[model samples]
Target chain A: MTIRYPNGKKYVPVRTSKSQKLKNPSFSNRGKSLEDELNESNDYYLSRGIAVIHKKPVPVQVVKVSYPARSAARITEAYFGTPSTTDYNGVWKGIYVDFEAKETKIKTSFPLNNIKEHQIQHMQNVTNAGGFAFLIIKFTTLERYFIVPFEMVERKWDRMKAGGRKSITLLEFENTSVEVQPGYIPRLDYLNAVETLMKLYDDKIER
Target chain B: MTIRYPNGKKYVPVRTSKSQKLKNPSFSNRGKSLEDELNESNDYYLSRGIAVIHKKPVPVQVVKVSYPARSAARITEAYFGTPSTTDYNGVWKGIYVDFEAKETKIKTSFPLNNIKEHQIQHMQNVTNAGGFAFLIIKFTTLERYFIVPFEMVERKWDRMKAGGRKSITLLEFENTSVEVQPGYIPRLDYLNAVETLMKLYDDKIER
Candidate 1:
């Protein structure tokens, strides 16, 4: 069975290949998708009682459905709806946390076009409302993930809108964004970066 | 077009009656559903820069989909998945706000069975994390709405689990819950109740 979005893009299930499986028998999810890793990390966070965060489900506008059984209704026609906010959001340490995660194959630069204008506006609103807002960008080729604060993104977005570079280069991203190392159990330990950013934000407020 | 959930309930769009329409031509959504009212109130809140809240989209597990055109793909088979958390959550005045909304026709008492165990647990978790968590209960017959804090519900849930009454009486609810009157523009001005709760919470913390 296969699932496709309204845009006709096939939804590929995250799975390990036979060759990769054979090479790394002990590590099954070594090459799993970014979403899978983040989900595992969130589960780890929840289990340990550290934080409660969840990825918002993909919004779908269902037009038709059929009830074959009392407990099994099948959606026959649905259209994907545009998300008004980011993908992930939850409460952390008495504060609201909101962010969007994206992966790119390009190693040179992270394209700003990957994020929508409404998302940036939403992040701005969150920040203004005294919540933590950021982006989790993953460079698939380099296998590196970084937490880019909304302020950094806002600056870059404004620069781009003012006829500057459309994308932030690898060096610029490395300097501005906080890199998060992947781990075995949690997979992507992004909260450490959040903790660091929170301290920095607090320090700035004090100054 | 009709959409059915896995529980065999058809999704009905909220519509005003012909008589209601004729009686109040100025008021378009006079007899809209609870969900519709909530959505409109959320929109009002967002537009006014008061808060940012959204109802989580219904989660569905898609089994099969077909692409009829490049721009449009239709889900042929899917099933509704159980939500792990409440329907609505967002940031308000630098605090995390989370709540579940339910409507009941029973005028004497509100049934505890309307709320799931996981939802109760989730609300507990939110409150523990220093976030605001509550339930918006609407008694359809009485045409009254109340914001019942998780602490109140938790107390009742515990007593019920210990072999007490399975429902909370209307008098008890009236005494414990913060009543919120319905309005025309926002329909359900829930945040007014939230504001009062916040002050009470702050006062308790100060003490």
Candidate 2:
């Protein structure tokens, strides 16, 4: 990288071009995407007596507020707040549950990069605290959803740090995951998956 | 309320005045009012895994938006959307729960006018579907919080509609209420009250 001071002094890069992008890749919802579908599913769950889980609203932090005469306050400067937890967390049947729902079109494997460091840490904390923690990874192109345990994720995460594979393959997903049936009334009746999760939690408790 | 169009004209009471007065009540957090304390208590509840409940953000429907820059969109006009449900709802100990949290300062009684018609209907729906529905009414002047059952609310609502008293007396609040100890976390840890609620719901299910 090169830089110049106000005096017009310039410097050139002595750095390696090892592929790190500064710009954030936008996840645009081109038309109605899986997020929209999940929103509908959430609404369906709320309407029926199945579950009550809501996607947290995009967090906004107001820095400068302007309360003009006879007008609503205008926020001039603000930035997105980093969520300390997963995108969703709720209780069902006395079980404290937390998870991130994701979808990608890649066919062969799911990239470990799709999961963030903070998210992995959050999942670890929840699991350690005797709560159910997992991910809803949906292969968009393949029309498949898998419930992958965070315990499995932790091992893979350590390997990736040690220069191992940077992703979880399709085979691993098929073998170590449970499928959630998407229905009409309660849409993604995830409580069923939660039932399976409860058994795992109970077994852990017993152990 | 009277208004003039482009031409000189007058009208009856406007539909918005009551809503505006209800919403923008000058909430003076003077030396920490009951509302302020409860809000803080709710925050305490959320952080400690005691209960999960939040005041719903006001619903705003944007009519026209101006995109003036890449990252800024200015809303031109927005109206309040009719909220069908109560202010708060969540799960507690494997039991489905929903409730409206309200505050009143009248020393004599809780005004029935403080309870809305649609809210009563929503509570009825929640109760019918095997959920614990309730109200957490804080008498500000008295510094007392009461857990009022939805069944009692339903009966009171019936009386109000039939041209009875516009509110319930302090005696009524005393007779059919569960007192909650005001605390820092889980402000109204109505679980003590939930025990009473659970019995009622469980008996109905057993029948």
Q: Give the Cα error of residue B116 in candidate 1, in Å.
A: 0.6
Candidate 1 residue A149 Cα shift, in angstroms, is 0.3
Candidate 2 interface RMSD after superposing interface residues: 6.7
Cα RMSD for candidates in order: 8.6, 14.5
Fnat for the candidates in order? 0.67, 0.03
The runs of at least 3 residues in candidate 2 whose Cα sits more than 4 Å from the true structure, single-residue gaps closed, are A1-31, A42-99, A111-134, A148-167, A180-207, B1-35, B46-49, B52-56, B59-85, B89-97, B116-131, B158-166, B183-207
DockQ for the candidate 1 complex? 0.45
The per-model DockQ list reads 0.45, 0.07
**Candidate 1 lDDT tens digits, A1-207:** 779989999997544476755422334346577888899999888777777899999998898988886667878888778899999999866778899999887889999999999999898888776678999998876777898888988999999999998998889878878898878888888988988876764432221
Instruction: Write candidate 1's Cα lDDT for B45-159 as tens digits.
Output: 8888888899999998888888886667778788788999999999877878899999887879999999999999888777766678989998876778888878888899999
Alpha-carbon deviation at B173 in model 1, angstroms: 1.5
**How far is A139's C-alpha from truth in model 1 (Å)?**
0.7
TM-score of chain A of 1: 0.83
TM-score of each: 0.85, 0.61
TM-score of chain B of each: 0.83, 0.74
